[model samples]
Target chain A: AQSVTQPDIHITVSEGASLELRCNYSYGATPYLFWYVQSPGQGLQLLLKYFSGDTLVQGIKGFEAEFKRSQSSFNLRKPSVHWSDAAEYFCALTYLCYNNNDMRFGAGTRLTVKP
Target chain B: EAGVAQSPRYKIIEKRQSVAFWCNPISGHATLYWYQQILGQGPKLLIQFQNNGVVDDSQLPKDRFSAERLKGVDSTLKIQPAKLEDSAVYLCASSFGTDTQYFGPGTRLTVL
Candidate 1:
């Protein structure tokens, strides 16, 4: 079974500070990885995805994720954190098998921005 | 382009009652998905539809839960004799053939 693990349940960082959220996956083959952000009372929005090619992938809202095959990790990073960036972050994996896509998400990490 | 749309952002019902949720996916999206998201947990896929046909429903509880995607555009999920454990946010998402899925604002269901 393919699964994603977000080790951080909650993270607090000062405004303008750098941020990194750890994610690890258990899968035998290369998997499609994604990062999604969910704000309170709103639907989740896609931040970035890594299908293939370059390991470092850029996404919306000044977010980026690096997929490391060796570590089986796809960590999300941002150069500077903002108050608006405080939300629940989820790392997801999608496996394509027999023309069907099965997607799964991690438990999610809630980020808090401190002044 | 319009994003996915869902109705009745919130619903409150007593246990053993029944409830239904509606979803309208983006135009031209062939794949539709329904997910259940309990508080403090990630969303779990309950069912998947490919152009009005059931593609994957292994996770869906067939006894009291049912869903349909008619015309391959709009879809509905219903739960009968809702249990306390069924209280969760129901999310609907759609994607173009094997593409990234776009989600709609979920419908929060509370079983008293």
Candidate 2:
């Protein structure tokens, strides 16, 4: 079974500060990775997804993630975070195979922005 | 385009009571998914349906939980004799194909 782990349970940052959230996955074959953000009382929104192509992919709100195959990591990064960026983030992993595409998500990392 | 819709937005029940959550997927969507999300955890797939037929439900607690997508448009997830551990948000999502899932504002279930 493929699983994802997000080491940070909660992170605090000030407005306009740089942010980085670590994610690691365990999968046998090539992996399809994704990052999602969930605000209070809102549905999960897709932040970014990496299926195939370049290792670095950019997402909304100036968020970006790099798919590092050697380390089995797809850490999310933001140059500067806005107050609105304070939300729970999740990392998910799925097999790249066309036959079985069941995806598994990490526990989640909550981000809090302090003024 | 209208996103996936779910209701009631909030549900509260005591342990051992019965509760149900309803979901309406996007028009023309062929796949619907039901997920259970415990507090501070990611949503876990409870069931998946491809047009009115079950695709995957291996993670569902079949002994006490049941879900159905009749007519291939709307879905309902029911829990009989709800348990305290079942207190969590029930999320409903759908996709145009099998690639990306668009989620709805989940129904928060609180079991007393």
Candidate 3:
């Protein structure tokens, strides 16, 4: 079965510090990976996605993710963290089941930007 | 363009009671989905519909849970005799073909 893993449950970083969130996925074939952010009391917003082609994909809100096929990882990175950047991050992969595609999400990682 | 819309942003109901959530997908989106998200966890898909037909619902608890996307636009999910474990956020999303899905502000259900 296809699955996604987010090793970090919660992370605290100083404002303006660099940030990186780890994600690993298990799948047999090439997978469509995605990153989503959810703010408190709000719906989830797409950050980035990797379908094919270049390994690195840039997304909204100054977020970027690199899909490392060898490591089976798609980690998200931000050059500098801001107070507004704190939120829950989720890594997901498109999976095929019962002849239809559905998304499987990892346990989310909550980010705290300490000012 | 308008994003996905959901009603009853928050609801508190007693166990064994019935509750319902409504969702209106983005105009022209052919695919609609409903997901359940527990606190501190990621969203899990419960049901999916392609147009007016059911595409996938392998994870939905069929005994007391039911959903329908009639006419392929708006949808409703209902739970009868809700359980305590059903306390979570219910999210609705929609997509155009295989494109990125747009989510609505979820309905937070608390079963006491």
Candidate 4:
């Protein structure tokens, strides 16, 4: 079985400040990683993804994540956060199921950015 | 692109009652997903469909929950007898392939 762990349950940062959310996964082989954000009463939107190659992937809303093979981590970071950045963040890992299925998500982290 | 679409944005039902949710994936998307999101928890993959076929459904509670994706386009999820623990948001998502999954607004199910 595969699982993802988002260490930070909740995080707070002031507006315009930098922010980082930690994520780690337990997979047997190479894993495809992704980050998603959900605003209040809204659907989940993609932030970024890492399939392979250089490892550093940039996404919408000025978000970026770097996949580390050694660390089993794919942390999301934003140089500056806006008040609207307050939302729930999730990390995921993609792998095939018994009959070649795909993707699974983490527990999630609630982000609160103050003004 | 219209993105994924789900009906009945909110639903309220008593325990032992039955309810059904619908979803229509993007026009050409081949992969569709159903997720269960409990309060204070992340969305869990309940089922996945590749076109009109089932790809994965191990996590889905087969005892009271059933789903189907007919014609490889639209889908429906049915709960035979709702339980209090079944109260949660049912999210529908789709992907062009297996690359990225896009989610819909979700159906908030409240079972009392």
Candidate 5:
């Protein structure tokens, strides 16, 4: 079974500060990784995805994630944080089983921005 | 393009009551999904459909939950004899193939 782990329960950062959200996954085969953001009262939005190729993948809203196979990790990063960026972030793994695709999501990390 | 659409943004019912939620996927989307998201946790896949055919439903609790996408366009999820633990957001999503899925606003189900 494929599982995703986001160690951070909540994180607080001041505006303009750098931010990083940790994510780790456990899967037998090479995994398809993704980062999603959910604001209050809204559905989950795709931040980015990592299928193959580049280890570091850029996403919308100045977000990026690096897939590290050695560490079994895909950490989301941003150079500067904005107030609007405060939201719940989730890491998910897409598993392909016998031509069927299933997505498993992590517990998610709640981000809060301080001004 | 328009994203996935779901109806009844919020619903409240007492335990053991029955409720149903609806979803309309994007135009030409061949895949649709239903997920249950408990508060403070990530969404869990309840069922998946590919062009009006059942693909995966291993995690769905068949005893009280059922879903169908008849025309491969719109779908409905029904839950009977709901439990307190069933209080959560039911998310509907759709995709063109196996790529990124676009999600709906979600139907918040509350059991009293």
Candidate 6:
């Protein structure tokens, strides 16, 4: 079965510090990976996605993710964290199954920006 | 384009009661999805519909949970005899046939 794993349950970083959230996936073939952010009391918003081609993908809100096939990981990174950047992050993947697309999500990691 | 829309942002009901949630996907979106998000956890897929037809519902608890997408536009998810575990944020999302899904401001259900 295809599954996503987010190793970090919670991460705290100082404002303006760099951030990296780890994600790993178990799948047979290449999968469509995505990063999504959810703010408190709000719906999830798409940050980035990796379909094919380039391994590094840029997304909204100054977020970026690099998909490494060898490591079976898609890690999200941000150069400088701001107070508003604190939120829950989820890594997801979609693959074909039973003649239809099946999407799976990781547990999610909560980020806290400390000043 | 307008994002997905959900109604009754929050609801409080007692256990054994019934509750329903409404969702209107973005215009021209053919795929609609219903997810359940528990506190401190990621969202779980409950059901997926493609143009008024069920695409995937394996994860949905059919015994007490039901959903429908009428005319391939609007949808409703209902739970009968709600349990305390059912208290979570119900999110509705839509996409264009395997494309990126846009989510609505989920409906938070509180079962007392």
Model 3, range B76-99, lDDT digits (tens) per residue? 999998999999999999998767
Once fitted onto the true fold, the runs of candidate 5 whose alpha carbons sit more than 4 angstroms away are: none
Poorest lDDT segment (10 consecutive residues) of candidate 4 chain B: B93-102
Residue B67 deviation, candidate 5, in Å? 0.4
Question: Chain B, TM-score, each prediction?
Answer: 0.98, 0.98, 0.98, 0.98, 0.98, 0.99
Clashing pairs in 3: none
DockQ of each: 0.83, 0.63, 0.74, 0.67, 0.82, 0.69
Query: Model 4: DockQ against the native?
Result: 0.67
For candidate 4, the docking band is medium
Worst 10 residues of 6 chain A by lDDT: A95-104
lDDT score for candidate 3 against the true structure:
0.94
Docking class of 6: medium
For candidate 3 chain A, the 10 contiguous residues with the lowest summed lDDT are: A95-104
Report lDDT (CA) for all predictions: 0.95, 0.91, 0.94, 0.91, 0.95, 0.94
**Per-residue lDDT of model 4, residues B1-112, tens digit only:** 6989999999999999999999999889899999999998889989999889988888999999999987999999999899999999999999877767899999999999
How much does candidate 6 score in TM-score? 0.98
For all predictions, the C-alpha RMSD in Å is 0.6, 1.3, 1.1, 1.2, 0.7, 1.0
Predicted candidate 2 versus true structure: per-residue lDDT over A1-115, tens digit per residue: 6899999999999999999999999988778899999999878899999988999999988999999999999999999989999999999986634322466899999999999
Model 1 lDDT tens row, B6-69: 9889999999999999999999999999999999999999998999999899999999999998
- Evaluate residue A65 in candidate 2 and report its C-alpha lDDT on the 0 to 100 scale: 100
Model 4 alpha-carbon miss at residue B89, Å: 0.7
Candidate 5, B42: how far from true, in Å?
A: 0.5
Tens digits of lDDT, candidate 6, B15-70 = 99999999999999999999999998888999999999999999999999999998
Q: Which pairs, if any, clash in model 4?
A: A97-A101
Q: Give a tens-digit lDDT track for model 1, residues A1-115.
A: 8999999999999999999999999999999999999999888899999999999999999999999999999999999999999899999999888657779999999999998
